[model samples]
Target: MDEIVTFGGRVTLGQDRQADDTERFLEMVGDRVRAARNRRSISRKTLSEISGVSQRYLAQLESGTGNISILLLRRVAEALDHKIEWLVGEEDPYTSDAVAMMSLYRQATGEQRMRVLEILDPDNPHLRRSRRLAFIGLRGAGKSTIGRLAADRLKLPFLELNEEIEQASGMPVNEVIALYGQEGYRRLEKQSVERIAATYDSIVLAVAGGIVSEPETFNYLLRHYHTIWLKARPEEHMGRVRAQGDERPMAGNPAAMDELRNILMSREALYARAEAQIDTSGRGLPETLDAVLDLIEKRGFLRA
Candidate 1:
């Protein structure tokens, strides 16, 4: 009884663990497959049609008798938009909200998750953010210049998120993106935000315009910082970039201006979510700086 004897009468190490548990494993797989299908509202016949597996075989598999092949199981998993590991793993996906919540969260858009967070945690944002302020807008919105000037005048610490990213990464922002790709860079950026939130209580921060395109990061900024949208006309944006000698925006692309306009139009709503806005469309450096400082003071953004 201690040793397992095969057909050739060759005894092997105790019982084959997998062999002895085959029935349990098969039952578990069947239960998972059925639960996944039911959760997705797909009948066995429909799943069979989608998975290209025979209905009889699927019925046997679900009844916990058929030893389904890996390839066929993979097909069923794909048909259910699930991973093969999830189907075969010991953990019951439906037993815990954490697993189900993560799946739902991963499938949801950034705006949807943001709204859900707002509903789930309706704490006072002003108090949560403390005295931190963030300036968000396109590249030429004068965020760095105005933010620095305002921070100097207000005697508050000023930090550029890109600079922080570069410092933490030991490389430039472009190099970080090149080395880690956009998704990796985004992860690093989120980490930087968390670090800043935990580090300094009062500071002026400038962030990239594309930050709004990322819903979760933007939502974090909204919750933890007094955000200001520094907007400018499309032409002004281009001109300012050109003035800074950064011809990258319109270097060789003839439709660069149009592209810039399209980007602005697309992100307008996201940027508009800021607590306040300042249009530096036609304003000079001094005027824009004054406007930003005035808005911050008038809005009492730094009030604790």
Candidate 2:
């Protein structure tokens, strides 16, 4: 239309001012659309073909000059394997616009969609605080510290599963795994989780990183507790574990780096099944705690 895009308070444009607002909005939208498209490796031509929004207009849309209807925007997002809300640049914060876009792209193309769906759209009997909430992620993920801090902040009792495991088995996790095998240790884990689930109230649980190995146990925990996967890059995980004077993680496993990365990859689907995920990457303890607080607040729960 060779007209400048502008956002108008009116439903229809008033020639000059409308053109200006629409143009600004269009530019912003186009910038976002292009970035999203590039991140997904989606070509402009393919989006045009699927959305039927035309290459010229698409280019203009990307340039912040074209203003199309939401209907057409939906098609464009769909073609890009995104949601209509993705174009809106906001969400309830549990699903930010950028995260939604990345998640949608990852889901459409990645193999982790099933697990992602379980977390993104879970089956819950109640929306209230879970009695057996668990935090499952790598060590040095601030589980004990964060779990304790969150418990203190919420005035809830916090229990470390590993401490329980060691007390129950009278052995370290590695020794337990070695002597009893993964299955035997998992039996203990299942029992521990089930016991907690069957008992307790207002918990901020800290689950073992390997807990996901037992899908049944993990799923059972999910049915009860609001799980949060404290996420971080591999380097950060190793540093945290080491900082805690836990060198066993690096022992014997000569390929510890690759192994940890691969382990994360393998269990990512399982970890992603939690009620919520907090990215502790490059974030301090306060920031991380604040994020957890924010998540809890947004979930519509009163702090313990």
Candidate 3:
């Protein structure tokens, strides 16, 4: 008979539960290792050689009796060309398409991975937005200038989303913002995106920098059109806008540059979700335009 000790009537039970949970987790890890090896048609001896873990240890591991160290498990995972988390994850790697897709996505080239993402996106299911390219960035990334140039060179229609919104509302963007408020403006923005998707199959589009702040609308844009993020330093962004005679960004705000940098930092991850990116910092307008065009052509962004 074994003596059980309890502290406050809970310790013994808690210990039992924790032990059982740990045993189950170890069994799961063992099962995954065995399954992965079997799927690859690798023998225990061969796995041992590849992973540098002894055959006896591999046997014990597969039998759920070996409490392998994390470093050793990592080596085995690498030998199997699988992520360690896949083996230890709650989802069964053998059955989960998500795990498989993640593995494939990790192994895929940038272009192929983007295609996989596009196909898997649940947001928009109608075929690819044919021959449509969108340039997205902050105010001074040269979206309008580069976008128009690329469109003309590619012989496609060029449309700026803000202009479309103004045309649709029959008012300037400032008036729309002033009268309807930010939320109202966002509603109009979403509608304009839908209209453009329906209207054009071959066009270069430029959109407001803040579009990425709205997840649904941004996801829709990503689903429909091939997107490119144009990047620039905060100073360059302010300088370019000022060069265009729009002093609103720095007119009275002493901290405008800091705010701009903060905005870029915060939205950096969201902007990176684009399929392609172009950094225009320190580049001449023509050089940036050529780079964007080259990327589009190289990536076959407009190909149906």
| Highest lDDT against the true fold, candidate | 3
**lDDT rank, highest first?**
3, 1, 2
For candidate 2, the lDDT comes to 0.78
Worst 10 residues of 2 by lDDT: 123-132
Stretches of model 2 off by over 4 angstroms after superposition: 1-124, 127-131, 170-172, 251-254, 301-304
Can you write out model 1's per-residue Cα lDDT over 1-304, one digit (the tens) per residue? 5676588896755466657698889988998899899999989999999999999999988889999999999999999998998889766776867778878988988657656666777686766687899999998999999999989999999999999999999999999999999998898888898789889878999998899988899999999999999999999999988999999988789999999999999999999999999999878989988888888889888753
Q: Candidate 1 — worst ten consecutive residues by lDDT sum?
A: 10-19
Model 3, CA-based lDDT: 0.90
Q: Write the per-residue lDDT of candidate 3 for residues 45-123, one digit (tens) a residue.
A: 9999999999999998988889999999999999998889988988887798887777787888866855765777734
* Number of clashes recorded per candidate: 0, 11, 0
Against the correct fold, how does model 1 do in TM-score?
A: 0.60
- Candidate 3 has a TM-score of 0.60
Tell me the tens digit of each residue's lDDT in model 2 across 51-113: 888999899889887778889898888887777666665442233676756657654732354
- Candidate 1 vs candidate 2, lDDT winner: 1
